[model samples]
Target: MTVRSEPVLVWDGAIRLVHWLMVLLVPLLWWTAEEGHMDWHRRLGLAMFGLVLFRLLWGLFGSWTARFAPMVRRIGALPSHLARLRQRDSTPSFGHSPLAVLSVFALLLALATQVTTGLFSVDVDGLESGPLAIMVSFETGRQFAEVHEFNFNLLAVLILLHVAAIAIYRFVLRQKLVKPMVTGRRPRADFAGADLPDNRARPAAMIATAIFSLACVWALGNFG
Candidate 1:
């Protein structure tokens, strides 16, 4: 007997919202920072910081696929995924694949490090300082500023890699990964197995995500 797979809502509403919002905010933050728009940079940074925190929390307590455990695949499984792609076979993944999972974790870690370091950084003219700059030593702040700048550059490279990976998955591997993210739907296949989402009613969950995200930004701007 042939086994059939059931569709499941792996990425819940909150997960999808955070995923796309960060996609929008990351470029905005990078551009503003690059242009030396410190004011806008600071504002966007706060928003990004809050997002990171919220994402971390959501990863811990959100829906099935949103949790790190399910998504965090072993590096050893990467070869199997690649092989499936090569053969044009359906790879059953309820969450991120091993390679993609590592990419997501690395990107988040890099961004978090950059933001926290930026909190203790200081500008060249001594006029603008990060929110926590006053708490750290002048030398320490200066070091963090340098590291922050370096890490931001690394983050840019990682973003490019991420885009390239998606392109490869879509065009080369013939997988519609982007469509699933944008439309909240994955293509069904005969061998897709048990990895499909069942609940597609994530619009309300997305709204809650937006509200919670805005609340975080407001609190950060007003208090932090």
Candidate 2:
């Protein structure tokens, strides 16, 4: 847990893969929607739906650092976290710092909203519908579509803020946060005296997470 003189692993491999895959998927979803490719958009939306489920499941049963308990503790420590931030503390946290955890949670909430609403969305022409849209009345489905659009705007804004925060960390704080998320390691000095967590997801955890994620997506597609 204590910092090492060598680059220390922070994000697990599954976490990194999920993070980057969503990064790739988001823009493709946007492009598909903009080009009136409703079919592709729905397919990609389902893919993202699967990824989000995977992440939530992983947070529960994956790695020590990826659990909700630690994130909740970090959120509860906001006062100390803010004090350390004001002092320009460079001591790396177990995974994401408290402030970053807030943003992470915010982004997740926003993305979750987007996907949840999209599930019941219906187009004005009634020609396109979410996988679950048929389960709802036409008026209700249209309302969900409206919320889905609004949620996308919220998601876009959150994403901009996220990128800006990364820039601030890099230029203002002199911290290269993105690199570690990509490489899963941080330089020794960046985490000096810090108790860095380096838990990787076990084979059992990964298998369970993947199977459960797929099952949830399948149930929604078939039943709803």
- Model 2 lDDT tens row, 61-134: 87876777788878888899888778987556768778888888998888888899999999999999999987
Scanning candidate 2 in windows of ten residues, the lowest lDDT window is: 192-201
> For model 1, which pairs clash?
5-193, 7-196, 7-197, 7-198, 8-196, 8-197, 8-198, 9-197, 9-198
Q: Estimate each model's TM-score.
A: 0.82, 0.91
Give all candidate RMSDs, comma-separated. 4.0, 2.9
Model 1's C-alpha root-mean-square deviation from the true structure amounts to 4.0
lDDT of 1 by residue, 1-224 (tens): 97555434545666676788788988898788778898988887887887787777666656656667667645668898778777876454656788888998999899899888878888776777677788888888889889999998899899999999888877776666776676554545522444354444445554566578678767656655
Instruction: Give the poorly placed runs of model 2, Cα more than 4 Å off.
Output: 1-4, 195-198, 222-224
Q: For each candidate, what is the lDDT?
A: 0.74, 0.84
Residue 4 CA displacement from its true place in model 1, Å? 14
